[model samples]
Target chain A: MAAARARSEERRAAIVRAALEVIAERGYRGASLGAVAERVGLTQQGLLHYFPTKEALLIAVLEERDQWDTGGGAREGWRLDLLGSLVEYNAMRPGIVQTFSALLGESVTEDHPAREFFTRRYAQVRAEMAAVLRAEYGDRLPGGLTPEQAAPLVAAVMDGLQYQWLLDPDAVDMPAAFRDFLRLLGAR
Target chain B: MAAARARSEERRAAIVRAALEVIAERGYRGASLGAVAERVGLTQQGLLHYFPTKEALLIAVLEERDQWDTGGGAREGWRLDLLGSLVEYNAMRPGIVQTFSALLGESVTEDHPAREFFTRRYAQVRAEMAAVLRAEYGDRLPGGLTPEQAAPLVAAVMDGLQYQWLLDPDAVDMPAAFRDFLRLLGAR
Candidate 1:
């Protein structure tokens, strides 16, 4: 039973990785289940046995990315400096960033499946960022804005920098620019 | 001859508007030329007479957006204050923003048609942003970085804030966040 379960888990992981590549190459709206299934050498029905639906597969892909970023929910103790480190880390992984950005860009349409996921995620991210800011700068940052007010900007900079860097890597150094932003935030 | 020219221009403008609506509803990759043609009351062959190709139509839509934002090349005098106003202006036009963002997101995918347009546009935008910073801050911003160094971050903040705002309008006040960013830039 243990060995059988291990094989199933491995297969599921493979499918998720394949889905990421397809989504990266084509935006989520452009990626099809058959394409993902073909990449992993499975029939469409075989892939469906694991993900059940394309939306389910997309959610799995997103969850897998978060796991990679947070090291399995290790973000509980993330600080502002740690966030800088995360930006640096992201620079090395263009494929993952491309997929995330593509999905994020597509999700703003009227009724995208990922719309709810990104909305909830951004809300939680803003709250977490506010916590990080408060822990680092007390209630008010140096510019006289509260942590809650500053959190969304922090999140925006990270996300926005990714799009620019992905489009023009040589011109926009994501990590260096992010450090510059941190300086702006820390300015007295 | 003058009347014919005016009618031609009007028809082209109508096609661009329909293309924008279609692209916003479905991402560039998911959007079909036939759908855009139908929306504009043209057969696909008739739409081809104006745009020639889907890529051409996409560029026209993008150019139209720039015209709206710049008031037909009046961006030469844009300062940081003016940029903040642009953000406020953008909030009122969610359809245009959604179309631009969708194309931008999809353009990052490999071999996407709009990739070249976005790449060149960012380079131009970054240079323009540098000029704006230099005009305001001379050699160095208050934070001590040169205008050239700070330019990408400014652009990133505006683009990034838009994504956050589009995803959750209730959570992110785009104009207010942009003002806070401007304050951060002017901080000593």
Candidate 2:
């Protein structure tokens, strides 16, 4: 039973990695199940053993990256560490942002898997980010900037910078950008 | 000759409006040239006469919106007004934040028209936003931040907020968020 579970986990990770590579090279629309399966050394049917549909697979890929980025929910105690970790994660998986946003823009339908993924992701990201801000500010962000107010701005900055980074990594000096934005938030 | 020019401009505007509506209703992948032409009471050939391809048409729509939003470059005055104008512009067309991101994500090829559009757009946006920072700080932002240091962060904050707005309009109070961020910049 342990061996079976381990193999399942390994297979899932392999699939997610393959999906990221495919998404990077071909984007969301251009990626195909056949190509992903071939990359993973699995037949389409074999790949389907893990993910039932492409939508399911896309959501899994997102969740997988989220976990991979977070390193298994290990961000419970620190705020600066969390922000720094996420910046690194985003910087590393830049293409995922494009795939994620494109899928989200199309996922307006309630039934689309990415809709729920994004909704949940936003909630989690926002909540955690807000928690970090509160920790740093300790009840004073000044200029009437509450944890509630600042959290979404933080998310927006990350999302918006991802757009900038998508076109030209050189366009924005990302780490410097993040640090400055953070400083602005902390200013009294 | 003047009448012909006026008619052509009107037709172009109509086509762009129709395209926006079509893309809004149908996902980008599902929005076709025929659907857009049909929406605007024109034949596909007529649409093609104005925009030779879907990509060309999409980029035109983005540029038109950009031009309309910026008041045709009338915000070329001082820095604060320019930044304030940007805040107001984003407040009005919050949806375009995601719409433009979605479009760019789908059209990532180096040859795609958005490649150039965003490249130039970033240059202009960066310069204007940097100018705003320079106006307030001159060289130093409170808390040891510099305009050269702060410009990219301001740009990132603007970009970041737009993405959050797409998922949840209420997530960030657009004008208020910008106001606070700007205040923080001025404080620096």
Candidate 3:
């Protein structure tokens, strides 16, 4: 029974990875369940047994991406300085960034399935960023704004830079630009 | 002859508008030419008389958006302070922004028709931004980076803030966040 459960878990992981690849190649709207199933060598019926719905598969892909980024919740302790390193790390993985950016871009349309996920995620991200800023600058940053006020911009730069870099990696050095932003944030 | 040409131009403009609405509702990948044609009261073959291909229609939609933003090439003299105003202007037009963001997000995938369009557009935008920075700050910004080095970040912040604002308009004030970014740029 234990071995059977482990095998099922392994199959689920493989399916999620395949879903990411399909979503990366085609935006989530363009990625079909059949394509993902084929990549993982599962029939559409078999894939449905695991994900239940395309939306469920998409959520799993997104959650799996976050897990990879946070190393299973290590994001709870991220410092402001570490963001630059994170950007640098992201530059090494274009496929994941492409998938995330595609989903984010597509989710803004009316009634998109991922809309709620990104909306809630940004709010939580803003709150976490505010905490990071507050921890570093003590209420107000050097520019005389509170951490809560500045957090969204910080998040915006990170996300925005990814879009630009993904479009043209050679021209836009993601890590260097992020460090430059950190300098701007630190300026008095 | 003059009346016939004028009518053709009007019909083409109507087709582009319908394409924008459809692309805004469904991403470029998910948006079908037939749907756009139907919205504009044309058969798909009739739509072909104007656009010839889906890619041509997509480009027309993109160019139309640029024309709207630049007011027919008045982007030539935009000052740094005007960027904040521009952000405010963008907030007034959610559908246009959503359409552009959706295309941009989907364009990053391999073989996307808009990929080359966006890639070239960013390079041009970066150069334009660099010129804007140089005009405002001379050889270097207050933060000591050259205009060329700083241009990408400025563009990133604007594009990035838009994504965040689109996801949760109430949580993020695009205009306010942009002004804060300007302040950060001007900080000594």
Cα RMSD (Å) per model?
Answer: 3.6, 3.6, 3.5
Candidate 1: residue A129 Cα off by (Å)? 0.9
Q: How much does candidate 1 score in TM-score? A: 0.86
TM-score of 3: 0.86
Q: How far off is residue A168 in model 3, in Å?
A: 1.4
Q: Which candidate is the best by lDDT?
A: 1
- B111-170 in candidate 3: lDDT tens per residue? 888888889888888888888888899988886778888888888888888888888898
Share of native interface contacts recovered by each model: 0.67, 0.41, 0.66
Please give the lDDT score at residue A19 for candidate 3. Answer: 85
Deviation (Å) of A13 in candidate 2: 3.4
Candidate 3 true-interface contact recovery: 0.66
Considering summed lDDT, which 10 consecutive residues are worst modelled in model 2 chain B?
Answer: B74-83
Model 1: CA > 4 A from native = A1-11, A17-41, A52-55, B1-10, B17-41, B53-55
Error of 3 at A166 (Å): 1.6
lDDT pick, better of 1 and 3: 1
Q: Candidate 2 — what's its lDDT?
A: 0.71
CA lDDT of every candidate = 0.84, 0.71, 0.83
User: With candidate 2 superimposed using the best TM-score fit, by how many Å does residue A187's alpha carbon deviate from the native?
Assistant: 3.9
- Candidate 1: tens digits of C-alpha lDDT, residues B44-64: 999899988777787788889
The CAPRI class of candidate 2 is acceptable
lDDT tens digits by residue: candidate 2, B1-188: 99999999999999999887776676455567899999999999989999998878878878877777667873334566456666766677544555665665555433456677776777677777666667666677775677667665676667666555555666556677777677666663
